[model samples]
Target: MTSDAPHSLPDTLFDTAVVAGVGLIGGSLALGLRQRGLVRRLIGYDASYDVLREAEALGVVDEIKTKPGEWLREAELVVLAAPVRVLPALARELAPFLNPAALVTDVGSVKSGIAAELEALGVRNFVPGHPMAGSERGGVTHARAALLENAVWVLTPTDHTPLTALSRVRTLVEELGAAPVVMPPDAHDSLVATVSHLPYLASLALTHLVARDERLSLLAAGGFRDLTRVASGDPRMSRDMVVANRAALREALLRFRRQLERLEADLEDPEELLAAAQEGKRTRDSLPVVKRSLLPQKHDLVVAMPDRPNQIGRVTQALGAAGVNIKDIEVLAIREEGGALRLGLESVEAVARAAELLTQEGFEVRSRR
Candidate 1:
């Protein structure tokens, strides 16, 4: 849409950029900045030495620092990529290091808590950000440069947050090839509570239920596996995310309980059940699909996936190798022969590339897009 974003990454925007963590989101940001040459000197400071070493070896950062303040003092851009719980304390600790002009942002999902912490510490430069992007896998090793492209990187800037600070963060986000969005801290936490946090809890619950039933394993299929995949993410991190946003999560759960009750009431009414299912399909299909780097907007590139082990992985590997990122996927009406796999790609070009690549690979690929 925008002249195919230069094959070369964006030009450097910061003299010195520092990321507090080298895990998934953090590592990916470092890789992206380094790839685009958007930051002259990228400094990384992670609790784990091994993660820092891996990040350094990957060339995700120009150097690894012994402390956050050491780099914070010199950084033109500082990214707090730590967990939600630690982010508050991080704000307090790093407050002394940041200058009035330094643009400080974070990758914490729960923003209100961190926003409060910054407010308490009179940290006006801190812009709370949460990039709604990640993989099932964690750590720096799996970090990819393409993760941030076209992803909605939400920035929660309260009344106290400086306008210039927000604008600077938006510019940085755009430099990383991401979509920058501004929202109030509490609103963001409340909204994500239902969409992001609740789903993970549901996945965890579903996985727990199925795991307790040994006989279900023999009959488990794509649908079951898809529903439970999020549960496979880091347990401690998952727990922390859910607990850290408890108030909003609690409100969301109560709302979900009402929906559950309504669904239960409609169980006896086939017509109501059918209507509910249809409405759900419409809502799900209409949801916005974030485009990834070198990929097209979310377009359904349909292909028949054979009901066999490694079938899905093969498609993913093929597309990934071709620089086609799958934003989302679905397996519909699965049977022994195969299932219709609807793959969401980023752009018109990505759809064409993916379809052509898959077709050339002997897969029956078709698209309505």
Candidate 2:
């Protein structure tokens, strides 16, 4: 067994973490924990030993354990990154081996069922979490280090969840550069049903309809490709998500059916349908390409700076120390070696002051707007 204390993670909250199921989420979390210095040691366990070996070789895990019980005994944190269907059984399997104080969390999209199952198994420290981020592709090979960066990670902790355990899980998420949003289990399921499950179902339906049309398949262009792109997601995963959130998904489908019926009714009158389509196009076009918070707000000054370390903090500190409140800020580009940073502020006065201060601090800052 490896010691928990490592020089890389001096302020680490969790000494050791075991990621169950070395798929995309598991592999990505292992990589993030190591890169961000969040944990001293990270180990992985998956049913596929070959994938586990591959993950270890790829540096996603420090070690691979075929026996989860052996690793769970030593882990301070255990993250269940398995499929939604396998989660309840996996929880039951690990329940006996888990330490009394160990923090258990899962990356499953559905929460209510898993929460109830864990509770029934006498797992009190479990905190259900779902990082609202993923790619259409699956597997550990597709796991990227920045998979969770700037993404909203939701934690649905039931009344039985320990406060300390939830806090530790939140810290782990933030360490991976994700923003943590707390919500009730049912609320999370309902919201995901509309925003995520419905979209997946729509994409699948759209893809099936297009595939059935011999002419449409041959002539499908960018628009069709873009709209049906998410249909390429792992079929098994999509099926599980739909089944898990069936109630909320049924509600969303009903609402979608009503909208489709309205459109069909309008199509009976060609002129009215055309006018409605035109109006829809106009409304979509009128919407701002980028949000105001993402872009510069009205009457705000936007400054562009080089992508140097401490450049943003320096500018913000200077403005903040001088009692200047930043209305908005956007990091436009960092793809190049000396890429520029964009800062947006409420007033021209703040911009002028910030620019002067940044220049005095020996940095290149320019006013973009």
Which model scores highest in lDDT?
1
Candidate 2 Cα misplacement greater than 4 A, ranges: 1-10, 265-369
Lowest summed-lDDT stretch of 10 residues in model 1? 1-10
Please provide TM-scores, in order, for all candidate models, with all chains considered together: 0.75, 0.72
Clashing pairs in 2: none
- The per-residue C-alpha lDDT of model 1 at residue 182 equals 72
Position 21, candidate 2: lDDT: 89
Candidate 1 steric clashes: 5
**Backbone clash count, each prediction separately:** 5, 0
